[model samples]
Target: MSEKNREGKRSARERLAVEREKRKAADKRRRALIVGASIVCVLALATVVGVLAANAGKSGKSSASGPATAPSGAVGKDGLAIPVGQDTAKSTLTVWEDFRCPACQAFETAYRPTIRQLADAGQLKVEYHLVTLIDANLRGSGSLRAANAAACAQDVGRFGDYHDVLYQNQPKETQDTFADNDKLIELAGEVDGLNTPTFEKCVKDGTHDSWVQKSNAAFQSGGFSGTPTVLLDGKNIYADQTITPAKLKQMVEAANKS
Candidate 1:
């Protein structure tokens, strides 16, 4: 063949190869776009499904107790608030506690044994009223947040577990180790029955704050200017560390007799 003819043949072959490469590139782009679109749709669907699940969980978690009835500015046990013990006990004891109050902790450690003994024996029922008086000071915000988180857990029927976990992992009442919103949610997550996100939202939204406020009002109305105030059978009971199990037992025994 002539040189020119050979060159012409070579040029035709190169043109065909270039067209094939272009077509291959277009096909690759088309596949990539389809894959990308599928991924996006899947992500969107997952998001919608997750949202529905959360809403369903929220509805399921609604408390049987309605809003608390605060008459005489005192919190009622009817609401989703944690009442400290089962409601059907023969006798009732109400305790106003501050989460960050050192005296409150002391009361728990010292009087808890007797109190639990009474509850276990079916002699008395205890209701812990969370007071926010200390929280008026900036130092008590941690306590307030924890209280709020606990109320959230209560709303979801996980108060007992959340209550135990909070006190168990309670941070020091110092600024450095203070409990924050995140910490409160973490504690809620530690509880077996608590839903972390719902509980967190409840805390963040300040839901059930009125109950806490009512507790504070009760503190004032009951003349308990401080925390760790114990009410035995609707009457205030006060004593120092020397207040013994025997004394508590006598008190309950008398209340029961009457």
Candidate 2:
């Protein structure tokens, strides 16, 4: 081969080598850019997830409703009324009621004395469960607010007195009067020593609102359909046609005898 042709061929090969190196460098740069972008995207997603998880934790801690510390001498927990009779009583009477229910008020008015008498006499123990069904049905928060107030009163050792007073002065279900914390405080005056500043603050602040929510949840989970559901010794007395206010005492007596 001629010297000039050899030199030309060698130069072409060197040019090809340089071109390959440049292409390789460009490919490396592109791959590095892609990897860096993927890492940034992953980090951003992780940060967003972390923030959402933190917010969820805060919401659950602040708004989750659960049991509270039971009042002195109370027999039950989580906003259930302490049994209002001797621990050794022969019968158990469970009542599910809503403060805003007119039927509940009627039931309370008709049978309050009998129930209190039996409980006081140590023949039966009454367990009151305050619920908020009316509030859910009536588009008002009155029932829940009143229930919360009752729980607060329970904390102050005046649940029974305050409970009767509430039923005695129950507002018309449509009126939603119990939604006003001031009105609830006014009713508290009916029960001796229940209208203290502490009580008032507890009511206004809805200190037991979470407890009320939990109690209402329990009522719903129990598969109960309505308020003023009366059970005698675990049997639903109201579900039977034969039970009446006049017969309630007799029934309790019968249950006690049995």
After TM-score superposition, what is the CA distance of residue 101 in candidate 1 from its true location, in Å?
0.7
- The parts of candidate 1 lying over 4 Å away from their true place are 1-81, 138-140, 176-179, 240-242
Could you say which candidate leads in TM-score? 2
Ten-residue region with minimum lDDT total, candidate 1: 41-50
> Distance from true position, residue 187, model 2, in Å?
1.1
Q: How close is candidate 2 to the true structure, as a TM-score?
A: 0.70
Compute the lDDT of residue 74 as modeled in candidate 1.
28
lDDT of 2 at 132: 70
Model 2, span 57-172: residue lDDT tens: 11112121433534445456553565667788888898888888876776676678888888888888988887776566545667767777787788788988998888888887
Pairs clashing in candidate 2?
none
Q: In candidate 1, which residue pairs clash?
A: none
lDDT of 1 by residue, 19-58 (tens): 9999998867643442222221111111121121122111
